[model samples]
Target: MTATKADRTPYLPQEPDLAAPLRLFCFHHAGGSASVFSGWQRALGDAVSVVPVQLPGRERRFDEPRIRHLPELVNALDAQLDPWLRQPFVTYGHSLGGLVSYALTRQRAAAGRSIPERLMVGAFPAPHRRHALVDADRLDDEEFARRLVDLGGISPTLRAYPDWLRAAASLARDDLALGLNHGIEAFEPLPCPVDVFTGDRDPLMRENDIDEWAQHTRASFSIQRVPGGHFFPWDSPALFLELLGSAIAHTGTRRASVA
Candidate 1:
């Protein structure tokens, strides 16, 4: 089940190890891309393959129009990621990514399709609660960009690039709509385990809201507070890698080899 040249797609920039013992399908925060996980392979060693899921309108997918709703993005991912789903894997998403990952899993469960071994969400609020920044959706382009930048949603260094302001704001606006426009929906809890974490200093993801993730999964649930702001994983790469690696070394399919 090893991937071939034909399996490569813009959605997944890196070659995948279908043969690996485990794979982690990562989704990036709004305004971010698969490049966020560029060093993850070396950081985690060969034990697990880190495959970042690049949503449209960012990175190489920049030419494509952005998807503004949650369901549409989930459906698109359902088809694009079918090949990688054949192997044992988990899903780790940050911020808006966490919401996308959760929606995708719920869709798979409803269809009796393959779901992740574990779902790990960082710096995100639980599904049912309206995200704290949902109101930001109403801001004008300029104000919107500034607000996101201040909240650490978009990097300040990107400001050097002339287009970063407008481009980042556009990407963030469309991506943010995935969660902002969608009302909460309830379903039978997922059959898989769910691990949740929040940045200790993040303004968007309150610690209390993180615990609500427990209601989304019927299996074992865990929550921890990591150091940093909304972008903790990048701000504290070593610590984040340590915590993430520990979560992967669980009594599950990660230990089981593919034939």
Candidate 2:
């Protein structure tokens, strides 16, 4: 089927803020929707235009088939968001979304496009490392659903509806599959600042492995171990935003000095 503009785009509802000095493109976790970053603009203040990106198959894009390959999705994203990317922006991605953000950065860099001022990767391990969810294809349906539930990803209310739980689980399975099979053998270190955020009790990323991200960037690198589990961005939105704001501020300061 020929894809519509809506089908081709991954970005979701975000009020236009042309005057905002900075643009923040937020990528959600696997099985998560753009709604995850709803109202972030107000919380972050007028300085930023909070643009929440929705991967296909969730929320507003539910009818659009999900891209199960990382490179494919990254290419599409780079094409769709090319215009906005030329402006000053930052990115924050959680879990599977972190891989997307990172890959997208590389995609833009390869094409000589403008990249983000700062990249905030949260609740995910370094892209080069083989993490626990790498073998998602091996897990059976029941086992996978249980794992998603155990991770506190799906809502408790979804349990009341077994069909909803199953749907959520299936989406998560596909999302994980893409990340596991991202097929990135070469690591071209990024040019911009890369800040890593981990949940204190994250099941996906180990504290010791957090340092691995330092090798992915030539510019500034920092790590923040914040409260909550893998879903800390949702669990502690305020704390995450505070840290994010500070990281972006530091990036802006550095850019000013270089200019």
Candidate 3:
């Protein structure tokens, strides 16, 4: 059974059997929700079961306050995920979610808990790399809204509508706050392999930033260049599916034995 919000743990989505060889856990970027991975489940093929983790204060969990601390979120998730650790799994996170995935793995390692068999980070820099960043979260409401629109990820249609715009701005502020406050102390590569993917035109990540993920993973590391901008997965669903299928297949062959 999945854990509930009252349990003070991360809540896993309800799904089918757990015997699948490839169980992929997906985490969303800032200001996004589990809905982002809605179509991915079917596109990933029957062999691979896609489990998307829903962060608090978004989508159906709108009542829940947004989580600002990465470790706090990871700790809560770890508590719930430990039970499911009985089976092999892989983690796939995008942008902010990528950092969350890595942090979660580290937390598991520290507690001697079972960890994912592999990690897949997309459109995000390596954890150990220093970044010249800003504190958008500290800005006033008006300024925070301006920054969100400037970022260009939020849908223009939503920005046009006042209610949607207000909601989006709130989420953007919380997401930025989470990123700004979160810090990576050190790097300890997971026992599993790592894969990094990025859009050739993604302005957020430089070529070196993408390549440097290799240094953080003692397991095998691979990088791929997909088409489109930062949100390439949304831009090219078919291509993303192809790459995801390949990753799942590779995981089945290697499992957690890669070194």
Over 1-259, each residue of candidate 1 has an lDDT whose tens digit, in order, gives: 6456776677887767756788899999888888988888888878888999988887777888889888888898998887778778888999989999999888888887778888999988888888876787678887888888888877788777758688888888778888875766666788888999787889887656888888987888998678988888877888888888889888366422111
Best by lDDT: 1
Q: What is the C-alpha RMSD of each candidate to the true structure, in Å?
A: 2.9, 4.1, 3.2
Candidate 3 residue lDDT tens string, 163-250: 8887887786676555664667566667778899898887678878888888777878999889877788887779977997798778
Model 1 residue 210 CA deviation in Å: 0.8
What is the lDDT for 133 in model 2? 76
> Residue pairs in steric clash, candidate 2?
none
Candidate 1 accuracy as TM-score? 0.92
Give the per-residue lDDT of model 2 (tens digit) for 153-218. Answer: 887777788898889989988888777757666787888888999989888888656898998888
Q: Which ten residues in a row have the lowest lDDT in candidate 1?
A: 250-259
The models' CA-based lDDT, in order, is 0.82, 0.80, 0.74
Compute each candidate's TM-score over C-alphas. 0.92, 0.91, 0.88
Per-candidate total of colliding backbone pairs: 0, 0, 0
